[model samples]
Target chain A: MTPAAPALPPALDILGIAVFALTGALTAVRMRQTFVTAAFFALITGVGGGSLRDLLIGAPVFWVRDALVAPVCLATALLAWFTPVRWWQGQLLEWADALGLAVYSVFGTMKALSWGVPPAAAVLMGVVTACIGGVIRDVLAGQPSILMRPELYVTAAALAAGLAGAGVVLALPPALTWAIAVAAGFGLRGAAIHWSLHLPAHGGEE
Target chain B: MTPAAPALPPALDILGIAVFALTGALTAVRMRQTFVTAAFFALITGVGGGSLRDLLIGAPVFWVRDALVAPVCLATALLAWFTPVRWWQGQLLEWADALGLAVYSVFGTMKALSWGVPPAAAVLMGVVTACIGGVIRDVLAGQPSILMRPELYVTAAALAAGLAGAGVVLALPPALTWAIAVAAGFGLRGAAIHWSLHLPAHGGEE
Candidate 1:
């Protein structure tokens, strides 16, 4: 595979890491954990999904090789530590998370495709990249993962990943494909957050 | 750096996978999930830790490459599905888990060291290898992870990993080192289970 998709712009990538790291730090902060715990939460949450994806694709782990990633996560954790919880509440963080989720999912798909993972598996990789970190954060924090709920969180990620894979198969312009994919994922997640949207619960039946 | 330790015997490795997979299946069974869910749980739990280790150490994922591993997990899940839950209740599973944890941790350390991971990190790799599968199982099942408790679980893994690392440094015979490391880990975990041992809870303080 000769680079079917270009790499994510560094600015958006760092923004994604920061946003995820903030959410992680907030989780620990809400739990009244120590600064160390918050920092660790930040680092793991920021890196978890991408790390898993890289591992599965037989590539070197991204955060381990990237010097900036850990420091960004740590700085985000510090920012969370010093700030009042109320200041970071409401739509702003949700919007940022939505953006991060979309961009990260698309980027993950592109990376996997470039690595020659089958397109179907690559889409799954994108979902893993977008969502596993939050799942891990919830798991570590002893909270119910959003994946366990009827929420549209994972569905939104699947949409992004699926669209990215489709774009690659169609041989669309990479930039246009990525932009559209990100917008679609972000819009879905944003709508879910705004409208309190969710999938129907699993009906108890045979 | 050379591979200072030999691989875990295949029989013992398969046994470890089977025990871990059984625990994963049992978690889903008790939750009243379907066979498909149980199988997924078993497969994930059996492979989760080692997969993470391989990814971190830049090695090929073991289960993805090995034909026997997935089939073993699936078979374990099938056994779990058909058997009455009570048949698996009691100390039997715990003993098996303890054995699996000990052996897996040692094996993980050996693999990481062979892969050029630093000794301290390799020890952590061992703990990750032993504990991560169970952690993932609990997370997916929405139960509180054993890691969050002040239990001797991780401590036991650390002991095994640490001892394995020490043996490497001391240039001891691999077989003797592995035997002692596994025994020490199992002994500690076993004592903890029998005595309901736990580390003291973190005191609420500034």
Candidate 2:
């Protein structure tokens, strides 16, 4: 199907990537890694999810072809390095991450749909877009993935992605649907992070 | 590039995926996971690298459209689950892994070159195809990735990919070039495994 919705604005896309890249650089810094590694983390965390989505959907990798993406990641890493890690404490990073999550989830679903992926797969693409970068970052840092702890991360993403996919399939207006999806996803994640809510774990196994 | 090389035989491709898939399933089994998780690991490890390569090269994902790939991975997972984990503690799996690595490395580089990626990038594509699946598997399993170890795995992949790319650019015959690339890659990996060789790590980093 032809893309019925407007393309995600390039500025918004850059902002989301920048925020995620900041978090990635922070992860590296906290690990006492070198500058090179910090840059590596930032780039991967910024583009990992989108790159995966592009790959899975048989599209060109976004960051590789885009002139601005790598520079943004690198610049973010440098910014993170110069700033003290302690300065990043509190809800600011969390809120930014939630924002990025919201934006990315919807964007991912839209891209997937445009690629002719099934509705269900498009929803999953949104979650992957919003979350897999962090997964890769966590894995690289040798930390337990946030996915294992059963926080509401994936659920939040699914909500946004699902809504976007449903909205498109139902022929709803794009702007209204995207707004609701973002708000819903961000709200859920915010509540989870603030209240330390966790999904129930499987008994007898970990 | 007219894909001067013939496609890699389908049987070899399936066998390679199967061997890697079994290792993935074994990791899940060792972690005391359910059959579902084992199957997940198997599928991811089997297709992870090739998917990454295709994404980078802007080609449709190979396994997504293939009918047989998922089934083979699932079958391998089932086999791994039933067999004694101890039975897998031999040189057989290692040999199989080396073989898969050799084939995947060459295949990845060729695909990238065919997609008009530069030689350097094509070499990297080879390494990604041969190694990233295992990386994803380890990440999902929450284990330290092989990238952290001083193994010659990536190096062997580089050798094969580098040679293959070089050979093609030099106008070598396809069949002979593929054979040499696979043999050299496997030989390097085999030597590393048999003799416990490792690339030197930074002294301070461990």
Candidate 3:
């Protein structure tokens, strides 16, 4: 089944942020932190990756310059607060995370390229954009980061990012390349989620 | 007692990195990871905050483009690997961390100012420079970040950064302000280390 490919600009961005913020808020709930802490967690997780990307690529940080970003994150936190977290769990959460990861990976790579960053670094920037927010969130919550797991998390991002980079190098159309990259990334992560796919733990040693 | 005011460029930079790397490696040793992991931890903690600052300020990341930076970190890691961590414990490490923190806070603020970042952000840039590397180290090592501790860690960074920003805004001489900022940061952190000073936690109501 083809996941809906979101091609819109700021809306897609907002959706991704809201989903990630929801996840961060859920984590705060698990930690028994206050609503203030939940809002902080939501805001950070929502903006964290793009902020890191903008910083690295020497662009004005996306959230800092945008007044609406904060409101969107805060609203997302409030939305999560009033809702039962069970509503966000299971396949729906996984699917949303997969989409966010894929889209952000593509967006980050494209932005880095626009900034004249080197190609390889641009690819890595994609992974950074999709992952670092959760790393920051997990660190703050004193939990092991999802990246620390043996899963296909970063691998999925890398596939999307690397493909986009290669497509750029090959002079592929931006629209087509983005579509392909997102689909591939989402597919990989979806499979991992369903099948519990993971990298070998400790060099496959006993 | 006055800490050594080493004004040399690159030497001071290397010294700061090496000391920070030593702390990262010691964390790894405590975590009982392999030497390679220790080296990875050392390199990341040494460069994490500066890397973050440079990225945010639109400067080239220092460790990325520089040859010496990696070597300094690796050498420090190797040294830590060979030494008994007990040798690194007690007051000496605290002193070194304090010195590194102070110097980095000043450097970060100055760099942000040079990049034309706003005054408040520049002050925050200072705290980010000195403290973020340790936060990253703590997170990667699966330990609660020192940031979560009720202590003067960030407060010391803020004092140095804030004073420097104020001085710059007041059109004070750079050298004198830099000296004052570093000294004040070092003194505050040193006092905390010596006296076990900390911020009040959660009303102490339990």
Top-DockQ candidate index: 2
Better of 1 and 2 by DockQ: 2
The lDDT of each candidate is 0.86, 0.85, 0.81
Stretches of candidate 1 off by over 4 Å are: A1-43, A56-58, A62-135, A142-206, B1-5, B204-206
Collision pairs in model 2: A55-B55
* Candidate 3, B22-51: lDDT as tens digits: 899888988888999999999888999988
Cα lDDT tens digits for candidate 3, A1-206: 22232234877778898888888877776555545456657867887888988777667676543546666777887776777666766689879999999989988888888777788999999999999989889878877798898899989999999999998999999899999999999999999999999988785555
lDDT of 1 by residue, A1-206 (tens): 33554466798789899999999998877776656557657877898898889778877777654547767887998898888888788789989999899988998999999888999999999999999999889878988897898878999999999999999999999888888899999999999999999999867895
* TM-score, every prediction: 0.62, 0.61, 0.61
Q: Which order, best to worst by lDDT? A: 1, 2, 3
The candidates score, on chain A by TM-score, as follows: 0.96, 0.95, 0.93
lDDT winner: 1
Candidate achieving higher TM-score, 1 or 2: 1
lDDT of 2 by residue, B95-177 (tens): 99999999899999998988888999999999999999999888788788888889898899999999999889998998888
Candidate 3, CAPRI quality class derived from DockQ? incorrect
lDDT per residue (tens digit) for residues B1-206 in model 1: 23454476798889899999999999999999999999999998899999988778777788897989999999999999999999999899999999899999999999988877767667767988998898888878878665555668877888999899999989999889988999999999999999998765322222
